[model samples]
Target: MSNDTKARMIDAAIDALQRRGVAGMSFTEILDASGAARGAIYHHFPGGKGELVAEAATRNGQDVRAHMAALPGTTPAAIVDNFLAAVRPVVAASAGGGGCAVAAITVEPDGDALRTIADTAFTSWTTALAERLGATGVEPAEAADLATALIGLLEGAHILCRAAGTLEPFERTARAATELIRSRYPHQKQSR
Candidate 1:
């Protein structure tokens, strides 16, 4: 029960962070969302709201990293497609209201701890993508560059999708990213 409550709180925190960001996410909101009781906040998160948000950010990052690590193909296109597919449900579930939790948190005021957590999460994602791309025969430097660009593209697309209240941005980005990855492997026949 204790672990369940903590997990619930973390899940709620992730949702709150995605939807409302750090300043907007309140203990009351988390409590209400998680139904974990008012005292549970301090008990589960000794560092208070900041700690909760940071942990939520870390959890979200780890989830993405795990998904990327588990992606099924060795080709760049497959890797990119699988990655975009992994995040599609998240964007849809939020109704395009929220984007990457780490990206959302970065918009808030800086705190070394929060920044460090966010930076590590972002780096982990890029590194994972770069590794996948390198495995597809892309040069190390080029793979890193493409991975960085893909992140930028997806993050930007998320922002645009939220603003427009549509998934068109994400869809367009997915296609473009897949194409970009495909272009990197001119010898391999492209998959539709």
Candidate 2:
């Protein structure tokens, strides 16, 4: 049950972080949301709420990687669309009422250590996208650059979508991104 409690707390933390930012994040709230005993917090995270939140941030990053991994795509352009497929439901489910957990950590005050984790998470995500591009015959350096741009557009879209409580930002980015792939990787047929 110890493991279960830890998982619950992490999941709860992620959900809370998404909707409520760090200021509203509290151990009691996490416990209530997770349905875990009070002691579970201290027992599982001796470093306190910060530790728990950091873990949740890491989990958030890993979850995105996993989601992207599960998507089907044989080319760089396909992977871009696959990324859209992976995250579209997430934004829709939140109805632009929430933000990414890792992003939340990066903006938190006095969160240097936590920010490092977020940085690593972002780097990992960028690398994964870059690898997809490279596998589709894009040069290593060019692929890395393209991946960064793509992720940047996606992140910016997330912010805009959340602020507007609509998916218009994503829709716009989708068009722009599709045009990007089509223009740059003309050899890759539009499989989607």
* Candidate achieving the largest lDDT: 2
lDDT (Cα atoms) of all candidates against the true structure: 0.81, 0.82
lDDT of 2 by residue, 1-192 (tens): 889989999999998888887777888899999999998888999999899999999988987766654556777778788877777777664455887888888888888999899998888888887877777788999988987887787677768888888987788888888788878778877664
How high a TM-score does candidate 2 get? 0.94
Model 2: residues with Cα > 4 Å off, grouped in runs: none
lDDT by residue (52-169, candidate 1, tens digit) is 8888999999998777667766677777777788878776644557767887778676677788888998888888888887887878998889878877876787778888888887
Pairs in steric clash, model 1: none
Candidate 1 residue 137 Cα shift, in angstroms, is: 1.8
In model 1, which range of ten residues has the least summed lDDT?
183-192
